[model samples]
Target: MARSIFPFLLLFLFTYYYTGVQSHEEGYVTAEISNKGLEFLKDLLIEKAESSLVPLELPKIEKSVKIPIIGSVQMVLSNITIEKIHVTSSTVKTGDTGILIDVSGATANLSMNWKYSYSTWLLPISVSDKGSATVQVEGLDIGLTLSLNTLQGSLKLSLLECGCYVNNISIKLNGGASWLYQRLIDAFEGKISSSVEDAVSKKLKEAIPKLDSVLQSLPKEVSVTDIAELNVTFVDEPELSGSSLDLQINGLFYAKNEVAHSKHYHKMLKASDSCNEADKMVKISLHENVLKSASSVYFEANKMHWMVDEVPDQSLLNTAGWRFIVPQLYKKYPNRDMNLNLSVSSPPIIEVENQRISAIIPLDFVIDILDADELIPVACISMVISSSGSAEISGHALAGNLKLNDFTMSLKWSNIGDFHMHLIQTVMSTMLKTVILPFANLKLSKGLQLPVFHGYELQYAQILCTDSWIVICSDVAPVEQLRLV
Candidate 1:
């Protein structure tokens, strides 16, 4: 059962990784699964152990024994099948090198065919009897050490060491003479115990490759948008402690058509105080560079352009709306409709500091005047805006709200003659309050999907912003545990 839990835990634990999370060439993400998290694993493991221990088929065992009078009898036990299993207890512990699992007081019920034959002078012809026997395996114990690492950005699992001890294997014959019981016990007692121990250990070891194969088969990157993909490759090996394990991943946003590269080094990311608390099972930390990667990709794809031809104030799209600000605009084209072509001129520069998610966004707008029912490109304006917000866990991604701060703007060019820089600020202020800020808040509320395991989700999570990194601590439970709760 311990083995069962360890493999599944290894399967989901490090698929999404983070780190001393600095500004890497690419972005970063890391995680810490504390002892609280292991408690959830223990619950899931116990359920799996019940079904996994049965259906174990051991190799056929043949033994040669010299009986008191039968002399030189060959006994073969074939089709040794484990019909039932009971696991009393199992424990999971994190070590300096890797993880350790201990299982004790486990037992199994087995059935096999027992065939024996002996050629003796007492009997003119060789004698043989074929019958069935039931085996009771008791006082079983196993201690295992497993080595978990990242291989080519995928999770890798190896069974480093395993020790299995079985105290007793009592065999009861079904159709045989009275003397056969003691003789069979005297011949097969030690052999049965050894064989049971070996078979049980083998069963536990087989689970590693199967789970490793599952982890390796998962996709390394996920398409987040038409122009970009989320890079989810593990950046480094897990850092193990007495109580928890930390794993880091290269969480960058890669261009859809760009080639990918391997990263071998990163900061050793550890669990923060917010995540190490007893109630929160896992802690996840993300760096600011991750957001920068996304912004860069979207901007490079030329997907940040937005045409604002309609707004709450319909007059904003007409030259009359800007008549007072740009006197010549309305003088030249009276009551003409206008269109504002807005684009993010550059990637937003994001900073995580002092519990705030802040950014500087550069923007450009092209104003088109409708003359004789034909739109005419007039002039363009450039602006820089500042904003701040707090992060939240929205589904699997980090979601947050931002407020635009004070920033200066001026005209980059003008066709209607130069106007005071202060005048343009007033018009932009109205658009930001009535259109841009509210629209941005609404769009950002949905958030983007982060690089997390597809099926698993964090529950009751909390987010904290710090220097160059943000952390979230949360609890997770499988459906079985949810039903129990």
Candidate 2:
């Protein structure tokens, strides 16, 4: 019985010790595998940098990883196909430090062609890091992209410690234009450049305090330092359209979880002059029926006002530029103070497809000064604007027939005969004839009578002529008057 008992004890002890050893060894192996993966990532990043149009260099690698495994493993990856590859290196030490990263040889190719009204993104990145003998890491980068819009930014810190200097850490991104453009826009916005430096600077300034908070929360064992500078450049300009944009950005970032650094840039080409001015503010509040594709649009200007304060320098570029016709309004109401209160329920409904515009516009006009005189004030020149068809206008001058709401004016002036006849011909040939012929021809007539005013009989009591323009002398105290010219 003693002999049997001794054998059983020996077997039990052996099994217990072997199981403990295997558990410890498995943990160690998992750590090593993770560290090797980090090294491989670093190497991959170097390769990408070497092949890029704008290469980058980072100072160090800071990372952490966790994995579940069965046996010892060694991973050696020769070549892996990826849409984009990135690398960042940061120093690992005891206190404050700098970070640097080198990025190069990142390539992007459209994997599949599918048109989408609204697009999204998915980012996959692999991370590899080596630290103390007890811990190791292998990681993949994962992120999100939605359409070709833009990205904000993110700073990740691994709260671990180690004296072992990380040599290489690589990150890879794989996606289509939807993901690429958003990332590029974000990175470009992150860098400081002359084109959009102010916008990017403001962003960085706001981010610095958050970065400091991250640094302060790091674990005691980890000492992060040595941040490397990053550079960003684009392969091509991002074409901003409705749903699609093509672009790419290559850059590097280097910093331990305990250290903080950031870069930002903003670039805008063909920017409007109104973008900088603050005094001229425009506020557009339109109903939902304005755009077919949009439910509603509310545009507010911080500096330049399109209608009230000052006309936009390049109003033509605005989406609603045509609605607020600056040139026509300027010429029509020069030196006049008018409150532009015009609203429309819908765009012109063309009864005829190619030649006409039939829109329902609720109009209200206030004219302070007519010609050079400030005494005449026309209030509420309101009318429903409903017109269509195109008319061919020609010639320089040809004044004859004119009519306005039961009122008629004719002319016989010889003092202005020297002016070009082509003006008269062109003015009468087109829509302007409604005003031009009545004003020009009526001025030469012996006398004129205005339509009734407040049921009171008021007629043009006098006529005054000058070398350049014509004026009507009315005796009924001009309260609300409508002059075609």
List per-prediction Cα lDDT, in the order shown.
0.71, 0.24
Candidate 2: misplaced stretches above 4 Å?
Answer: 1-359, 367-375, 386-485
How many residue pairs in model 2 have overlapping backbones? 74
Model 1 misplacement above 4 A: 1-27, 38-54, 64-74, 117-130, 175-187, 261-273, 371-374, 394-399, 446-454, 479-485
Error of 2 at 269 (Å): 33
Give the Cα error of residue 413 in candidate 1, in Å.
Answer: 0.5
lDDT of 1 by residue, 1-485 (tens): 01121211111112223322122333278778888787667656655765886788878889887768768988888898888878788888988757887888888898888888889989899998887888888888888787878877777878899888987777887777635555664577777788778887888788777867987886778765466777877766777898887777777766897876634434334434464456788887876666666667667777767777778898988988888888888898889898888777888777777678787888888889876778788888898888787656655555556688867687888787887678878888889877866766565566645444434556666777777777778887543443454
**Residue range with the least summed lDDT across 10 consecutive positions in model 1:** 1-10
Q: lDDT value for candidate 2?
A: 0.24
Best by TM-score: 1
398-445: candidate 2 lDDT, tens digit per residue:
112212222111222222122233432332234224432334234323
**What TM-score fits each model?**
0.83, 0.17
